[model samples]
Target: MPGASPAALPPAERAAYGRHARTRASRSCHGWFEPAAGRPDPVDVLERQSAARLPELVPIRYGRMLESSFRFYRGAAAIMATDLGSLPHTGLTVQLCGDAHLLNFRLLASPERRLVFDINDFDETHPGPFEWDVKRLAASIVIAGRANGFTPKEQNTAVRACVKAYRRRMRDLAGMRALDVWYALDDADHIRAILSTGTHREEAVRRAGQAAARARTRTHLQAFDKLTRVTAEGRRITPDPPLITPLRDLLTDADAGLRQERQLQSLVEAYARSLSSERRHLLRRYRLVDMARKVVGVGSVGTRCWILLLLGRDEGDPLLLQAKEAQPSVLAPYTDGEQYDNQGRRVVAGQRLMQTAGDIFLGWTRVVGLDGHGRDFYVRQLWDWKGIARPDSMGPDLMALFGRLCGASLARAHARSGDPVAIAAYLGGSDHFDRALAEFAQSYADQNERDFAALTAAGQSGRITAQPM
Candidate 1:
């Protein structure tokens, strides 16, 4: 059957293959978690990653990770990838989110101008076992629960809720037509309708509505107002020191500055070629006004991220785009290597495969001689109605509800690329898989705390610098 395509198989046969997979790795086996003998030092792993990043910005990455165990987990994707690689997997592959932590799931504005809840990050995305993403998400819930002072039982409750939703949603997707599954999406209105059926229906609906409303206000125009100032020359991005430094401020030499600016313009032109004809025409209407190196996110702080400010018709009409560096996925070492030559293309492809609707401006390009080197970057609108979640502020009930939403959303993403029929068959109709994942979540959370301590020790020993932003 190695030569046979699973999608070409009959429904019953595909399910049989799923059941057969249990022989290679049983469902209960997922409950176990212990660092393999002589596991690599977690801090050493971080140091290796920092080696390729901007040296001055690396300390900021450490400072952000040192904030809390949950924050540490957010930055520990590479470390976790090593651990998960040592474990037995189901071999059910999907376009993984690579770092599917709770925070990465958010509300994003679709191309149709509708707000949809989905996975918002793809820097670490690649093809790998589907359980990797689920485990990453489950462990995040447990770690977040601990941060919120939740009891062990309550934490387990939330983990189970998440896994249960994934199982049930996969089952539902298994019964749908292929085209229907591909077209299905979870919009904000649907999210509100789902919340309305919950035990805390009124409160849930109110929260959902408020979040959606807030997301709508986070448009490009809003970003322009907050990030730019009217200068004698024209409107320019306001420099905020280390966090946001304009291109001119970064290059002390006038010649170097002019050269870098030209490189940026070329980068934008290369990225525009990746877009559709209409989108390229739409983008040509805007002129690149300014660019700033911006530090963003807990794990992405050290990466090369640039915010491009473009003016459309006039000073009042503007567009903000983010060109973020795309490195090789953390999952790359654990799974088959990526198919794309450029990491940016790999990211863009994975995102389009998993997301129901994506950023219309999403594209990739390679920039050479920009900073005496070459790098791959994916470009997208900087502020497109994104709604972030605050897990630390959530109560036990709210956490569980949020977990269910994240789980369902993750399942939908997996179904788009992986075999939902096989996955549903493997999950079966019981809570066995859910309970196993819950147990694993607790064990992994303990491991995360230990890793967090290791990083703290490194900082205290002066082995690493941590400069708070």
Candidate 2:
């Protein structure tokens, strides 16, 4: 077990865990009705744990008014479900690309310049109801559609379209050859198939195509302007006003940071040894120029995410790699000890297994920071046309198209790890699960509202420091 990562639990042990998880899924056919084995009440658990976590998590409270635009938006799930605690189905699950909200689906360029659609986030991925994943997607459509001013009728239509498309794709998946499902690439053919079905969103799809076509390695010439200066000197990512800052400003000042930089270099080298030879060779050409502990995303606001500016020959030539702290997925509690212990490796390995062609630089490493607490991180190219259309940016027709694309893409991604044919068979030819999910979506939305309220109330009584919703 020497040098073994947390994910590298002994094969016998790993198999045992998988088996237990599978058994739990089988017994869960009655859903949460029978209560998860040794499970606490969902609401009670949420209030207790999330509240105890304090400023460790987001401290946002609801906006000032009951009728303000913000309050209406406050805690509304991406979709509405009646009760997630219901539903009878298989637990056939995988490390879901967790948090599959509608907006998480996006366009990223494969090394070959082929634009593919896939889940772009993995922070909360872990084993759970494949239905939970769908429930979230369905709800996001309703919530985001409402935000766009879609009429209730239009919103329902959009939500229904999202669900049915998942059903249709699941059916299609049922018939796919194993290799076809495994090796399927979300390439031009996939996008074209979804696009041809609608004329209303033609322009938007074209824009996506154009954006993807333009994605490539962050090259020296083109990226230099954004990265750094050579004003009679060397290269690096230029410090911007508010967003990008030098490593000195944030981590430590002066050569003291250079020492920390060396430590990181050692860590990165330790990381490189874990990859394939081709990747090591590709990595050798780049050296770290600068790094900053930059904040990223709303939910991920407090997580340790560092942007490392890398270079080849000069400051202008830049490649950005983000080394994000990969903590356990939020789904871990529900899953219990039924997952990879090294959550970081789980995230990286799952991404590589799930993504057809991942970033060449994708690698995981462990590092002990100045605090002496070790954290694991998976590093990858920062931005390579990995762009998603804003969920709120689309009108009704476009949102429907986007929803279908999201559903189909999710089905394909899940097919990479689980037997899609089996999942499809479970789904069958009807909309049973679809309707079930809609109910779950509504219920979960209500739950989120309550939880959001709990967080606000906790903050109001001086129990926790929080920003208003």
Candidate 3:
């Protein structure tokens, strides 16, 4: 609504757009995405420009073999941008957990230790098209399915089923009581039904059990492995080679030092208020053990992340909390509400709204960062009952089942935030969005190949520092 004029963009922005047209990447993107209009094709434009602009991201290329599957999983996510950022849409939007791939939907324990399925990532959230979310979910299903040897037709059936289920779920949600809308999620009954279905029954049951068992907060006794040592001095974070580094390895600036103090000062007051008096009482027992600016997420390589270690009673007994900078919801600008100045606060609020049971430590704060830029972040447990079932690991049947679950979960999330009836009407019980998204997914996947090739070429030519394949 801010700039709804279809005929023309405002003059200053038009001038700036014209200026960017002269750049090499911009001109090259225009060759395909926006050939006649002098505008870059949105997908091509996005991919091409993003590939070049985000040089700070440690680019990961195709066919890179790693010793660990988790490392490979994180590396492979870079290519997913093609599907995530390129969807044709009407712009009806809601807060989205930006990385809504099939694998990202999983069972997490509620506070009561009951497993619940929901969206589990929010790193790339920012206002854009809702179709972008759906398309990403569908394509992740197909790609992961193909990797696991599923027929194309089989994948399509899964995709259609997901769309159908989402439509039905949205309709049901729209008719709920206002409070009921907020209360909606996978209840114990729903989990039992899915477990009874016998589709990947053994795996689901194991995951549910794991979720329940690990739902306990990581206390000091179990926090450290053989690597960490406790002495008379304050507890210090021991570094692991290659993967985990100490804060002293990277952080040196005195200014960066004060910035963290400011965050702590703000966080202490705000989060303390959000907690019940009983939880707050628990907080008084711990002293700030250590804090560090940490790196996190696959697509969120350059984003800001921080970890706080809290010591309770003795140095060895600790509570670990992570405060990561939350990017704005992709739907915020289009969805109704005040635009959040701090994206992290938006993320925390949105998560609480959409998730069935949230982390007890979840809270928000703002601070000036090491770069002297003002930032906002929300804090929570480093890992709750989170376990991603990799897309590439899914067999055909498993992939389809995964897709339906993601579709159902996404429907629940959107229904809680957006007007479910209108969204359902917009979907119209048809495959228009689904098929359009499938078409978009294929087109974008092809584009991902092109950009991946370009990035690989650039890396080979010594133009970028990429993880070697």
lDDT of model 3, residue 23: 41
Worst 10 residues of 2 by lDDT: 73-82
Better of 1 and 2 by lDDT: 1
Candidate 2 per-residue C-alpha lDDT over 1-469 given as tens digits, one digit per residue, 9 for 90 to 100: 2234323454355334434443444432322232224434333443343442224333432222122222333223211122333344355665476677875788887777667888887766666556667767776777666657787667667766777787788667656666777777777777877876765757667866665655544332455466556544465456762345566665556666767777677767877876799989878888876676654554454456667767876543567777877776656644433466555677888787667768777878888776577777778777776655766667888788888888888887776766454466556566665665555444444454555565456557765555443
Please state the error at residue 173 of candidate 3 in Å: 1.8
Consecutive 10-residue window with the lowest summed lDDT within model 1 = 189-198
Q: Given candidate 3, what's the lDDT at residue 395?
A: 59
For all predictions, the C-alpha RMSD in Å is: 1.1, 6.9, 9.0
Give, for candidate 3, the lowest lDDT window spanning 10 residues: 26-35
Estimate candidate 3's alpha-carbon lDDT, on a 0 to 1 scale: 0.57
- In the range 154-236, model 3's lDDT, one tens digit per residue, is 76776766665676777677667667878877854675555445467677556545544554432334554433555466566
- C-alpha positional error of residue 430 in candidate 2 after TM-score superposition, expressed in Å: 1.4
Candidate 1, residue 71: CA error in Å?
0.7
TM-scores, each model vs. reference: 0.98, 0.79, 0.75
For model 2, how big is the CA root-mean-square deviation?
Answer: 6.9
* lDDT against the true structure, each candidate: 0.92, 0.62, 0.57
* Candidate 1 per-residue lDDT over residues 1-469, each given as its tens digit: 3557667999999898787778877899999999999899999999999998999999999999999999999999999999999999988888899999999999999998988999999999999888999999999999999999999999999999999999999999999999999998998766876676657777777787888889999999899999999999899999998999999999999999999999999999999999999999999999999999999998888889999999988999999999999999988988984578889999999999999869999999999965577899999999899998889988888888889999999999999998999989988999988999999999999999999999999999999999876
